[model samples]
Target: MTPTPVDIPTLLEISPQGGIEGRSRRYEKFLGDMDGVYRDEHAWQDAVGERGTDDLVYWVDDHRYQEGPGALIVGTSTLLPGRYGEEFAVTRGHLHAVADRAELYYCLSGRGVMLLETLDGQTSAIELTPGQAVDVPGHWIHRSVNVGDEPFVTLFCYAADAGQDYGVIAEAGGMKNLVIADGDGWALAPNPDHTGYRAD
Candidate 1:
């Protein structure tokens, strides 16, 4: 006798701060330990003090798919307004382990920038705002940086098998450039911490 398969439903609702109400995994980055992640170590200590730990920098809510293989993995991230040194608050950034898996990101609210880089050293930046959607191609390492006064919210989706390779970015000393506030606007400047970065 064969067993019957029951259909299960999953619903998710996002709040203003990019929180998805449901079963999810949250990941956070703090300012205290981000000195090595940003370009300016001096500015980081000045902005958040040397031992600041209570400040919430950014977080991601990963809604893992439980339907088995080939299911879509969805997630949302909220980058709070602040600075890591002279750089804005940002995701640690990562590349897909498969190197051929793609991802899509939709901006829910606030403003930010999406940074993309290839393993061969190619780099680009996309300005993000409310209602904007960006497709991240395969083999590209990506990160999100918040440049607004308010929280930056983004919803993203990708394949379940698209595992992340975060250590590559960390070993490379983060992205080639950093998004920073310039007066009332934002600017992209070279990251001092980025080693072996080539403009070409």
Candidate 2:
């Protein structure tokens, strides 16, 4: 099949912190008929160390469904303890730029804010919880944080396919994301699954 073009901007979403101390309202949904499976905390944690010791541990779909010409499906575990038990994780934040693929984030559990920044001095923040799905549009620099007691788990659906999307990340700078190995372990700050994708 040919790759479909996506209006990535339409997918970027950000939730603001609310409820006095920003206590998030929980959201839920049943994936009874979804093609993906959910793995628990133990399995998620074990896989992290095996892959690269990720502090932002989460489960993933690997691949759920194809939306645009390219695609990505990710599932988070829960947020890690931050100040006063707020969940959070900080990656190379400024790295891994995509070429027109929309990045989608879903709050499976916990409450938190999605923080985004760019190398050019632009910044954006969003708060989200269960039952909400936010889209991180293409060509923007971004990252996320979990701010609730439960670990922050969300699904990431990529706009571009693995070969062209993750590849560039694997070949750049000093940091990278965690990916599955031959038997479900993670690689140590390994290169991205694919390369050469850039904003157009």
Candidate 3:
């Protein structure tokens, strides 16, 4: 059966950038009750390329957190249910040139590696597992790839102010340059920095 949409409250709690700050406070009020959102089967699989990867079966859309003339562009977690050792694509994550919004990811179950590429041609990898959360700050181009031994699931919380100058998402698809950067320079893109931001 097709997956149904999720509620606002549930979306907020499970998302990486969601939930009330302070782990201790979150436990006192939530007790890790992310409702029905599980980490192992909730993080959506990103679709890369023309044919696209039909991995993420569930999505929450650009609502829930999208507020303001409103730049609060938010979407809930997605689900990818493939066994580990198999490579998978998450989403073709994007951000506008001026939008300083932050992307948050919260892991509910399973463990996986994330591949992140910045707009300036930097790359890195991150190890993720259950009950862990990671933040993808603003002004950087990024994407999430599932490199794990088991199915990976997690929640995503997109936060942005609608009025920002660059609040749009730009996909790298069809961009021959591969990597875009300041003024007059281009280079063949390398693996993205998933663990941290670019040094330059």
**Candidate RMSDs in order:** 3.3, 13.4, 14.0
Instruction: Name the candidate, 2 or 3, with the larger TM-score value.
Output: 3
lDDT of 3 by residue, 44-103 (tens): 222122223432333333343223443444443443433211224343344534446667
What are the Cα lDDT values of the candidates? 0.79, 0.40, 0.40
For residues 59-144, write the lDDT of model 2, one tens digit per residue: 22233334445444433323342321111342223333444445677776666566643333344567777888778766555555
Which residue runs of candidate 3 sit more than 4 Å off their true CA positions? 1-58, 61-66, 69-75, 81-87, 149-151, 160-200
TM-score winner among the candidates? 1
The clash count for each model shown is 0, 26, 30
TM-score ranking, best first: 1, 3, 2
Work out the TM-score per prediction.
0.86, 0.45, 0.46
lDDT of 1 by residue, 1-200 (tens): 65333224568787757878874588877766465666676776676665475567888887775545677778898988876556777877888887898999999999989988887877889988998989999988899988888999999999988898877777778777778878887888876677753221
> Residue 65 of model 2: what lDDT?
37
lDDT value for candidate 3? Answer: 0.40
Question: Least lDDT summed over 10 consecutive residues: which range in candidate 2?
Answer: 30-39
